[model samples]
Target: MHKYFTIFKDSYYGYFNYLWSEITTFHWENYFYGLIVVSLLVWGLEILFPWRKNQKIFRKDFWLDTFYMFFNFFLLNLIVLIFLSNATAQLFNDFLGLINLQLSDFQIVNLNALPYGLGLLVFFLVTDFVQWNTHILLHRVPFLWNFHKLHHSVTEMGFAAHLRYHWMEPIVYKSILYIPLAIIGGFDVEAVAIVHFSALTIGHLNHANLGWDYGILKYIFNNPKMHIWHHVKELPENTEYGINYGISLSVWDYIFNTHHVPYDGRDIELGFEDDHEFPLEFTDQIIYPVKKKRSKSA
Candidate 1:
């Protein structure tokens, strides 16, 4: 009994240590402050320069999304990322060993050896491509759609809506990207930090209800209007599945023929077309993906 208790204690303490280390190493302070400032800035802009003039400042289900933003950033994301990162790293190592191969054997160029700016550019491009593909899969795959549908359930859009995703999302998306990043192994911490910061900013902007078009550059970078169409209940004629899966760069959507923007204007009627009985409460939303229901295209 004493030996069993000792083992339990060690296991508990080890898991706690790992969790603490991950939280401390993740630069939470940066994201905490950045999110606060970004939220306030985007919220202010949306209020002052409203895109949908009829939309309310305090729209329905507003507080639920506020809870989502806090839940993801403070709890769910940190846990999922840390756990997934560790698991993926172990699985990757084992798979490589089983294949009798090494990452060094696949090396073409050392991206880290390049100049700082260029290195960051390469890292960003690689990770962004992985993310874009993952976002597409989340929509296309039937099983994955359940987890992703929570984000689309938002009828009223706002900056906080960007972080409103099912808890499993980051786990799958980041784990898939981890394989490539681990294999390449040249990206510096600073380059990754820049990529994450940029992604966070772009994500918030894409979800914001502000009224600024990016002109010709909208073809390259994702903006509010283009992304808003992504959540629209209606789609352009002849398209069945969702469009605008690009996370940061609109170029991917353009290249893949998934690019969609209304010639008329942004669609105000956003969310799944058939979501008449979707849950509004935060706890209900959290359990939504598990509930038995016929899935429909968003």
Candidate 2:
């Protein structure tokens, strides 16, 4: 099964490579262009088609999100890539070798056999499943939730709120969950990068305040309209949690029975009941969860 899946994944990657080459001439500049285009599209959608009326973009949140965007792209990703690449390579090689399995032995099918967009879609779906489970675990386990709760304290939900996540998240999700997937030759570096970038962009889009009809697309993918509701203050209402797990598609949520679709335009309040006393400043946000835990213990 592992070998067969790897062959399938590689075949998809090969198709993506060929299609991307044909469409844009395969220049390094074109790769950067794709990145810029995606980023700009996300920004434009946030402004033009917001999900919630109350979750308007604020200057302070915008600056913080910008800081995190730069931090993750420039520092966190680079550091994780450097530190974990070799370790991941060894881990996967050892695991597969123990089972006498190798993905390279499988033959490649025709490069153009599969749709290139499907490759991007599958990449997002698989990674989002892993991320959603990781997120649930962080919340369930007390120690990890200490850091994760800082994210939930956001009073507003918008594109920037996606970046308001705890710093520990990238470490766990990218290093542990994503690296292993990449190591088995199931996904290439480019695909993995695309998944990360697309997930962040889509997650932010889902959190934005703009209103737009996703129509049939809402059933297939996550729209900001559905995701803003995830930030609702009420517990069970807030707990409509795992719907639209994918940054690009909602297939995983549908598969896992976590998908939710709202019918009405309801006014939902954001922020945690416990977080009312805490400050939203970076330093306070960082330390408050820890202090709260300590006080509970004492």
How many clashes in candidate 2? 9
Against the true structure, whose TM-score is highest? 1
Model 1: lDDT of residue 186: 69
Residue lDDT tens for model 2, 13-41: 55456545645665443433454465567
Task: After superposing candidate 1 on the true structure, give the runs of residues whose Cα lies further than 4 Å from its correct spot.
Answer: 1-29, 103-107, 293-298
Looking at candidate 1, the ten consecutive residues that score lowest on lDDT are 289-298
- Across residues 138-196, which tens digit of lDDT does each residue of candidate 1 receive? 98887888778899998888888999998889888877886677555667666666787
The residue-level lDDT of candidate 1 at 105 comes to 60
Q: Local error of candidate 1 at 294, Å?
A: 9.9
Q: Name the lDDT of candidate 2.
A: 0.59
Each prediction's whole-model lDDT (CA): 0.77, 0.59
* All models, RMSD in angstroms: 4.5, 8.3
